[model samples]
Target: MKKGLLLIYLVLCQVYVYAQEDAWVYLTDKDNTGFSISNPPQFLTQQAIDRKNSQGIAIDNRDLPVNETYISQLKNQAGITVMAKSKWFNAVHVRGIQEDIDALATLEFVDYIDFANSSLNRSASNSNRQDKFEIEESLIDFEYGGTQNQVEMINLDNLHLSDYTGNEIIIAVLDAGFPNVNTMSSFQRLRNNNDLLGGYDFVDRTDNVYEFAGSNHGTKVLSVMAGFVQDQYVGTAPDASYYLFRTEDVGSENPVEESYWVEAAERADSLGVHIINSSLGYTVYDNPNYSYTPSQMNGQVAFISKGATIASEKGILVVNSAGNSGNNSWQIVGAPADASKVFSIGGVDASGAYSSFSSQGSATQSTLKPDVVARASSTFVIDQFDVIVNNNGTSFSSPIMAGAMACLKQALPSVSNEQLKQFTRMSASQYTTPDFMMGYGIPDMQMALNLALSVQEETFGELKIFPNPVKNELHIQLPSDTDTTLMIYDVLGKLVLKKSFNSTYQKINTSSMISGMYILRIESSSGSKTFKLIKS
Candidate 1:
């Protein structure tokens, strides 16, 4: 009797373990093309759930179970269990194994799957972005162009970095490693500011990956976000904080690299990575057969893309590069790039013309892609020695925007990631009429900031501009008592006019300016202010 009872207990324990694997916390891959926050895909089978879990290596917490009807419907599918159903949305976390991944990919309702991976601190980045204008004329960086654009750097000089920095808005940059950052002069301020949160090393499965500098990619990405510079390559948001995860190893673009990214995303979420900017893309790899076909662009085919979307739904922001495909035939968005929910950035020249290298759209039946464009060609960045290097790619664009979003999030810490994305689309150059070419168009940081502030209060400021459509002679007033500076910019973010209006009351004239939308910025001894002006 004792032997029989023991056997029964052992059998029951095995069943429980299998049951645990059968259920998982379901999350949408907001960055995945066919799946994610902005575009969600349907769950397929149990096999699909297991596959995604194997990729993510993270738990989807199966505290809840799927409804009876839903379970009955999914009975035919392999590796699938209705772990739980969301009362609000179709999104639900499920469980299964690798076979489920294949099954779900074939299902019409399935979008993508993220499996569990154990690697950590792995990140990817959009490395090449241009802060300098890309017009046909000689491009001037923020420094030299300040005079021509009429933007007074001095006006924005006093804005305290921390006042606009948010602790919760952290991004984990996955790349080779950053050994020189602590000693590098360009990144010293970031280190001193303690801008870096703790990180992990997935390659060795050890914590000692930070000791040596390996790939320049991660370092460059960090420089674009946190590198402190006044005249040199100023990151999109210099004061913003970040955490660096070393997931990529030197020299090899391993097939397992995707697994590493999954690990990084999990760690990033645990450590509260507000955003993820990975410049890497996948199509070809060490395993040629493992390479993806255009048909696999559905989002579930690639492990990393699946994980990218999973991260986004967890409230972590994810940005990916559309790929440098302008020069290639497979010019469409890559794996994770094909994932729907994530923001895939494209590259534009200093002339504002789209670059030939920027990857195209999500390939699985033409979905929205390159959600936005930023300066990527011949863009300036800090290299190994803090020297400015003009490189190009959607890789750099992602980080610059990530940094800017960080500042925006800092300005309004309460704004959910969903709302931020919505604002970005609505305030974009092509919000209402989005195209596959540019998801919404480039984002204007100033306008975005102004709008975010406006939503928070009855009025962001008591300031106003008159002669609303004045072709010239623009007028302005503010309620601040401190000394002030005035600046006017064109719709292109180029400063066309500027003056000092330190007095509490002052009249300004822009009668000589051309007709178009303009921005009037007010800068008190305190930071700065922005206004939307129209010249007709």
Candidate 2:
């Protein structure tokens, strides 16, 4: 009996060794055919092209699709499972035996083979269940219910009141799965208006995301953004369009999910998604050997981090959860959340206090993370049954902030993705003294929008107003010499002053004006310019 047991043990060890041979092959270059930057329609949607043109972003080789010939030939192989493909890295992820991985290196198009899995030793215990810290659930009558606190906490209600409901803005949500979203009443408006674009279940290689048997985390996460049920609960961006993507397999954690996320991001870019909300983060894995160390939390280390950064560079706003590991032994933000360009959101309570389970960061490489905070404690989200459930975690916070960003985008469509990030950070309450746990602290959507408006006015309008809080005199500078008609009005739209001039520089006297705020509109041959002015 002892001899038979030893034989079985040896065989198991051999199988484990073979499984460890899975790798990702990076190709040096792609075969140039059928794709061109000048002709973007072949691989990019018109919306995507328009976004690039609006931002003055140049389409280059990175926008090109991966060589289909190479992918087709690779798929024909018997022993390999083509898990994911990345256009940004020009690589293909595969699961195979040692012999097959070794054979891939010899291919002429292959650049080099690298072990995609981390080499760190995994813990003997395979189970590492993450705990979620949530506060009490409070029920209320139909009318924004418990969700009103979250929107008010971030000051996004002001924007909502302004009628900026993220109309015409496209957001792509990448998560585990979105089960029951199609039938949920909260999503009825989305379906009625065709706001819910088609989605895919990448884990199962199917386009039926709603029918897939998976976690309901995605449905809840998305509810924080697009769900609406009269006064019971209303998401931040109720009018925004969405594309749901299932990139995670909750049963296990491995490098393959990172590849799946990259593939989804690439698709989002091609479809002209303006924003991507990812409530998923990675760290310890089922296979200890595939887990990432804290030191590897640098923005450039993880594959998902790199992918998120590339997505941001492509003019797409990428928002990620900072992970719910703050109270655990591994108390730090996860990959993709550590990415510099990715807006990592932390969780706080309605009273502006940090949640105990919100991940802290300044990565091991010492870069501040959890770029901003949002109310997640006892946050209201729609369940698969279309019921509001109070929950907590950065997962809830991420979508809340993402929805706000969609509104901000709708208000300032010309602001570049990078500039949007800067504006949000600068508008945060703790911008000048950000801490590791909360980074820039909670951001104010109204403040961020105001800042973005200033930037856009300066960039396009080319009109400058000095001494904004003018006591008696106000000056306006136009970009060029043209006939200009200036009109000033009170907040109620009552005209206060009107003047005409043709010089590039002009000044007006307002010594008798009362102390208040007014809107200054300039109509010229170039265009119409509006400015918010204050009087002392």
Candidate 3:
């Protein structure tokens, strides 16, 4: 009996290595048109694409096996608990004893192997960055809205645009609970569209999460992501689909909540959730031993954070809140948000400064956290009864930004998630340089879309408008072996130049043109289209 016990313990220790042998995140092996398994519909192509992005791996370069040969070997073997036919990464997710893990690292195709246990549920990430700009805290009293942003918060015409709206994209919002959300008038369109996919309650370990209420955090979260209340407050992407997840315990402090987050994330993946907006985080927990040290911010200590990272690898864009400890002594960011793979979001005031209460970092492991920021302090949300309330914390900031990402995703459906992230960063308020407070800075989604779609200046599809703020010289591009048309118009909607081409390329010398706001429209038969060209 004693010897048997020893053997079992040894097996558990080595299982991870063995299990990892063929497990990999297949980024380049995508064929995603759609999915239909659960809430958001589980899509592998999406998940894998996300993983390839954070690793700094090029989308094309993502094809290399995290563990290449071990995958083939495991597929050939017969006794392994897991078997392979075809896989997300061209590798299989193997099940083995702890004794197997070491071997996994040696596998050629194996990038890194992690337990899949946590993916089923995950906690909301916490608030992190704070606005550097400080104003009267009561900006909402006179403002009535929330934080005073240069761009005032706008409300959606939910009552008026009920059936007629251009928003049709799927946006998964991972929050706490949806109590009364189903019965609210504000959420009527969401109910009508049946846009909400099924969700799991990771907190109480039961599905009746909606019934148990408090501040109805989840309801408020949904409102911010997709609520439509005219003249009051509006979410950035109100028309997007939603999958509400309950992963936090507004009541407890046990360290176990992290596990719940992991569980939620797995479910999100299985559902092929387009975007996961988790506004919870872990730094200190109920257990004294559980309180994470700054080192744990590396993104490897917590199961939920690791799952968040893996989810990103799988192509599901995960936007997480940093933490609300920015004003505290331990102002460093929290777990999962620290996960190098996830997009860590910070809170900022309208002036584009970091929120004082937003957490800070460059992570210990995957440093350079809080990828972006949004209005957090003094933000508005809807309670369970559909009443609007102003709140503070990075929690409010995450959904605001997530809403924007959904719109961006809808606008640039062809760009890969990795490209989208990169493009957004490049097009940020501080792309050329970065500040610790706001990271890469805020994003200009439409501008990002334009840049992503822009053809190389030297290439035919490349459309160039030169002489900015200029009195002359507007140039056009012509690519080889392609049909082309270039049209220019002034701000007054006057058509300035319209040309049809039979040559590989054409150049329009705007040198003889007037300087003002101009729009250039380019269209291609290959389903390629771009809009908004500035002519100076």
Which candidate, 1 or 3, would have the higher lDDT against the true structure?
3
| CA displacement after TM-score superposition, residue 23 of candidate 1 (Å) | 20
**Least accurate stretch of 10 residues (summed lDDT) in model 3?**
150-159
Query: Per-residue CA lDDT of candidate 2, range 1-536, in tens?
Result: 99999999999996775485446788878666578777899999999999888888888888888897887777777677788899888989888775677677777888977665544112122337454323344443445356788998888999999999999999999998898999989999989999999888888899999964657889989999999887677899999999999999887667889999999999999999999999988876656656677767888778899999899889899999998888877778888989888899998988999988899995374468889999878788877877777777789999999999999999888777777777788778887688888989999888778766653323236778777556799878878888989898998999989999988888899887876567888888778867776655
Q: Per-candidate TM vs. native?
A: 0.58, 0.82, 0.61
Model 1 has a clash total of 64
TM-score, prediction 1: 0.58
Per-residue alpha-carbon lDDT of model 3 for 1-536, expressed as tens digits?
Answer: 99999999998865643343322222233233233223221333454344334445444312322233444455454434442212322434454443464355554445554443332112223323222222122323323444225123211122113331225555566666789877888787777877765566765556565675443667877777777666555566667787666766666554445555655665665555668888887776432333556766888876567677766776678888887777776677777788877878787866666788888885365767677777776676666767766677787777876776676676666566766776666556765467666777777655555556652232224544443323354455444446766677876889887777756445566655553346677655543344444332
lDDT of 1 at 125: 24
Q: Which candidate number would show the highest lDDT if scored against the true structure?
A: 2
- Candidate lDDT (C-alpha), each: 0.58, 0.83, 0.59
Where model 3 places Cα greater than 4 Å from the true spot, the runs are 1-166, 213-215, 363-367, 455-458, 461-536
All-Cα superposition RMSD per candidate: 15.6, 6.8, 11.7
Candidate 2 lDDT trough over 10 residues, lowest sum: 118-127
